[model samples]
Target: MSEKLAKFFKLNERKTDVRTEVMAGITTFMTVSYILVVNPSILSEAGMDRGAVFTATILASVIAILLMGLYANMPFVLAPGMGLNAFFTYSVVLKMGKSWQFALTAVFLEGLIFILLSFFKVREAIFSSIPLSLKKSVSVGIGMFIALVGLTSANLIVQGDGVILALGDIYSKEAIVFFFAFLVMGILSTRNVKGSLLIGIVASTVLALILGVTKLPETGTIFSLPPSLKPIAFKLETHNIFTWEMLMVVFTFLFVDIFDTVGTLTGVAAKADMLDEKGDLPGVSKALMADAIGTTCGALLGTSTVTTFVESASGVAEGGRTGLTSLTSGALFLISLFFFPLFSIVPPAATSAALVIVGVFMMSPILDVDLNDYSEAIPSFITIIMMPFGYSIAEGICFGMISYVILKLAGGKKKDVSPLMIVLAIVFLIKLLAPKIFG
Candidate 1:
C-alpha cells in the first residue's frame, strides 16, 4: 500500500512537477470559468432565482468535474453546457410552452438515455463515425462560434434590422473598459505570461473600479453560500416527461449534448496524447458515463444539461496529463461557491478577453488537418467556416456532412463516405426543407 501510494505521487516517473501540474490545473479551471456565470445568467432569464441557480451551477461543476477526474481519469471539466441551455430555453420552454420544471424533467430523461447508450458503447461508435474532415471542421467552426459568443456576451456586437449587426461605439465607457482589458490580456498572452487569464481579469476589475465604471454592491447582499445536496432530494415535473412535445425536446437535447461532449472529449484527448495508437482514449466510456450522470445531476439541481467543455483543451496544450489536474480544478470550483461576490465583480470584458484568447489557442489544431489535399480539405473547410456563420452546432454539422457526401460523390469515391454521413446528409436536406422536423 505504501509503495502504491508513493507511485501515485511519483513526479520523477511522470516527469511532471507539482508546480507545472497545478499551473495546468489553473489553466483548465480558468478556461471553463465562463460557465460559473453564464449558466445562472441563462437560467435566471428563464425565471429561476439567482441564488438557487448559482447553487446549482456550483454543485454541478464540482460533482461532475470530480467524477470526471476520479472515474474517467481525464483532465476535463464538466458544467452546465452553453448550447444545451439555449435548447432548454428556446426549444423546450419557449417553443413548447412548458414550465421550467417540465423542461428540467426532459433533461433528466435525456440524461438517462445518454447513460444507457454510453453504457452500451454507442457513444464511442457515434464519435468514431465522424470523419476526420468533419472533426477538423468542428474544431475551426467551434473556434469561430466561441469568438462570436465572446463578442456578443461583451456587448461588442448587437442585433440590427439589416444583414449587418451594429458594432458598439468604441468610445463608450463599456467599450473602453473592454478594450483596455482586451489590450492587457493580449499583451500578457503574447508575452507568454503564466496565469494570463487570472492576471488579466484582476487587472480589468481594478481598472473598472478606478474608472468608476464598476461599483461594489452592499456587503450583506453580495455573498451567500451555494446550496449543496438540497436539490438532490427535490423533484421536477417528472410526470409530464413522456408527452410528445417533451419527448421531442428530450431527444434533441440528448442528441446535441451527447455529440458535443463526445466530440470535445475525443478531440482534446487526441491533442493531449492520452489516446492510444488505435486512436482510442482510455476511460472514454467512463467519461461519457460521468457526463451523462452530470447532466442528470444538473437537472436535479435545477439547471440545464451538463457536458464536458472543449475549454479543457487549453489545459491539455499546457501539459496537463493526469487526473490530478482535474481534481484541483473541481476543488477550486467548490471553493469558489463562497467567492461568488468577488468573481461576480469581474467585468465581462476581462472574461471575454480570456475566452477569445482561448479560442485563438484552440484554433491551432486547424493547421494539422490535411488541407492541401482537396479530399480531406473541402469538407473540413466548409464545416469550419459554417459553424460561426450558422450560429448553431447542429447546422454546422449538417453542412459538414452534406459537403462530405457531395464531395465524395463528386470525386467518384462515394464508398469512402461514412454511413453516418449519408444519414446526416438526408436529415440535413429534410431539416432545410421542412424545418418543422426539429419542431
Candidate 2:
C-alpha cells in the first residue's frame, strides 16, 4: 500500500514520503478544520439549513481537495470560500434584497464562467489586468469584513443608539470566551503550533459549555449519520437570471471568486517553489479547473462558492509538495461527516475566533500595496474601508475600481489603467446609478 501510494503521487519526484505527506495533510486539515463550523454558521444566516450546509461544505471540500490532489498534483485544499459566503449572506441576500436561491444561481453561473476562463487560460490575462494594489486591498478589505462578522456574531460589537456601532457587554460569557479563544489562538500560533486554530476553537467551546453559553448535544447526536442535503441541494432559482440585477450579482461573484483562488494559488505556489522564472505556476489551468468544478458542484449541493483554501500553506510549510497531502486532507473531510453534531454545536463565539484569525491572515497582502504612490494608496484605502462600511464586497470592489480609474485619469496616469478596468468602471457606474435613475 505504501509503495503504490508513493509511486502514484510521485512522492520520490517531489522528494517526499507517504508519512510526510499524510502528516502534512493532517496539519492542513487541522489548520482549516474550523471551516466545518464556520461555513454553515454563515450560510445559515441566509436561511440555509445549517445541517444541510454543513454536509454540502464537507462534500464540496472533499471533492475539490481530492481533485487538487489527484488531477492537479498539488497540495492545496478547497472549501466554500469564507468571504464569498459572507457576501452571499450579508451582501447579496440581506443588503441587495436577493433571495438565497438567487444568490446560489449567481454562484452557479460564476462557476461555469470560471470553468470556461480556466479552460482557455483566459483567467491569467484577467489576473494581470487588475492592479496589484487593488488586489491586495480587496483581500485586506474582505479580511476586515470577515473580522467584523466575527465581532458582530460574538456580540462583541452591537448597533449603537446614536452611532453606527457600539460595544457589547464585555463581561458576558460569550465575550469572555471569545477573548479567551483569541488569546489561545494567538499564543499557539506564535509558538508555531500546528493546529492552533482548531485547538483554540475546542478550548473556547469547552469554556462556553462550562459557562452555559452552549449546551452539550445528546449522546446520539454527537456521532450520527450525515445530514441530508434534500433541504437545500440543487435549489438554485434561475428564472430571472437574465435581469441586470442578476448580471451584477454574477459579475460580483466572479470578481471575488477570481481573486480568491488566483491570489491563494500565487502565494501558495510561490511558497512551494512551484513557480517558474516568469512567476507562474506550472499546470495552473488544472488547479483552476479543480476550483471551478468544486464551486459549480458546491452551488448545486447548497453551499456558497468553493475556492482554494489559503490554509494549504500549512501543509506546504510542513514539507508537503505533492498531491498526497491533499488526498489526506480530503479523506479527513470525508471522515468528519459523522461528527456533524459536534461541529454544529460550536457557538458563534468559538467560530468567531477562527474567522478573526483568518481575517488577520488575509491582511498580509496589504504589504504588497506600495503606499508611496498616492494614485495606488488612495484606491487601496477606499477598497479596504468600503467593504465593512458599505456592507457589500461588490460595492467595495466597484467603488475601488471606479476610484482607481478616475484618479489615474485625472492624474495624467491613464496608461496605468487597463482597458478592462475602464470598462468595469463604466459598468460599475451604471450599476450604482441605476437605482436612483430608476427610482
Candidate 3:
C-alpha cells in the first residue's frame, strides 16, 4: 500500500516519503484550519446562515484541495480567500446594497471567467506580464494585509480619533494573551521548531480558556452529521448579470483571486524548490485551473472565491514536495465535518497568532524588491502600505498597478509598462470614478 501510494504521488521523485508528506500535510492543515471558523463568521455578516456557510467552507476546501493534489500534482491547499470574503460581505452586499444572492452570482461569474481564461492560457499571459517590481510588491502587500488582519482580530490594534490607529490596552487580558502567543510563536519559529505555529495556537487557546476569555463548547457529542446545504447552496441571483456595478464587482473578485493565487503559488513553489531556472513553476496551468474550478464550485456551494492558500508554505517548509501532502490535508478537511463542535472551541486570538507568524514568513520576498530605484520604490511603497491601511487587496493592487505604469511612463521608460497593465489601470480608474460618470 505504501509503495503504491508513493508511486501515485511521485513521492520518491520529489525526494519525499509518505511520513514526511503526511507530517507536512498535518502542519499545513493546522495552520489553515482557522478558516473553518473565520470564513463562516465573516460571511454570516451578510446574513447567510453561519452553520450553512461553515459546512460549505469545509466542503469546498475538501474538493479544491483534493483536485489540487490529484490532478495538479501540487502541494497546495485551497479555501475561500480571506480578503475576498470581506469584500463580498462589506463592499458588494452591505455598501452597494446588493443581495447576498447577487454577491454569490458575482463570485460565480468571476469563477467562470477565470476558467475560460485558464483554458485559453490568457491567465498565464497576464501573470507573466506583471512587472517584476510589482510582483515583489504584491507579495509584501499581502504579508502586510495578513498581519493587519491578525492584529485587528486579536484586538491588539484599535481605531483612534486623533490618529488613524492606536494600540489596544496592553494590560487587558486578551491583549496580553495575544502578545504572549505572538512571542511564543516567534521564538519557536526562529528556533526551527516544526509545527511551532500550531503549538502556539494551542497554547493561546488554553490560556484564553483559563483566563475566561473563551469558553468550552457545550456540544456534548464529538461527532454529528454535517449540516445540509439547502439554505445557501446554489442560491445565486442571476438576474443582475450585466449591470455596471455587478461587472465592477466581478472584476474586483477576478483581479484579486488571480493575483493572490499567482503570488501564493510562486511563493510556495519557491520554498519547495520547485521553480525552474526561468523562475516558473512547472504545471502551473493545471494549478490555476484547479483554483478557477474551485472558486466556481465554492460559489455554487455558497461561499466566496476559492484560491490557493499561502498557508501551504507551512507544509512546504516542513518538507512537503508532492501531491500527497495536499491529499492528506484534503482528507483531514473531510474528516473535520464531524468535529466542528470541537474546532468551534478554539479562540480567535489563537488563530490570529498563526496568521501573524505566517505574515512574518511571507515578508522575506520584500528583501528582493529593488528599493534603490524610485520608479520601483514608490509603487512598491504604495502597494505595501495600502493593503493594510485600505483593508483591501484589490485596492492595493489597483493603486500599485496604476502608479507603476504612471511612474514608468513619467520617467521616460514607457516600454517598461505592458499594454495589459495600461488597460487594467484604465479599468481601475473607471471603477473609482464610475458613480460620478454614470450617476
Query: How high is each candidate's TM-score?
Result: 0.88, 0.75, 0.88
Model 3, span 110-146: residue lDDT tens:
9999999999988777666667666667667767777
Better of 1 and 2 by lDDT: 2
- Against the true structure, candidate 1 has what lDDT? 0.73
Query: How does residue 40 of candidate 1 score in lDDT?
Result: 76
Q: List the lowest-lDDT window of 10 residues for candidate 3.
A: 270-279
Off by over 4 Å in 3: 1-20, 94-98, 239-248, 266-277, 317-319, 433-439
Best by lDDT: 3
TM-score of 3: 0.88
- Candidate 2, residues 11-92, lDDT tens digits: the string is 8987889877887787677667778988999989988899899899999998898889999999999999877999899999
- For model 2, what is the alpha-carbon lDDT of residue 204? 90
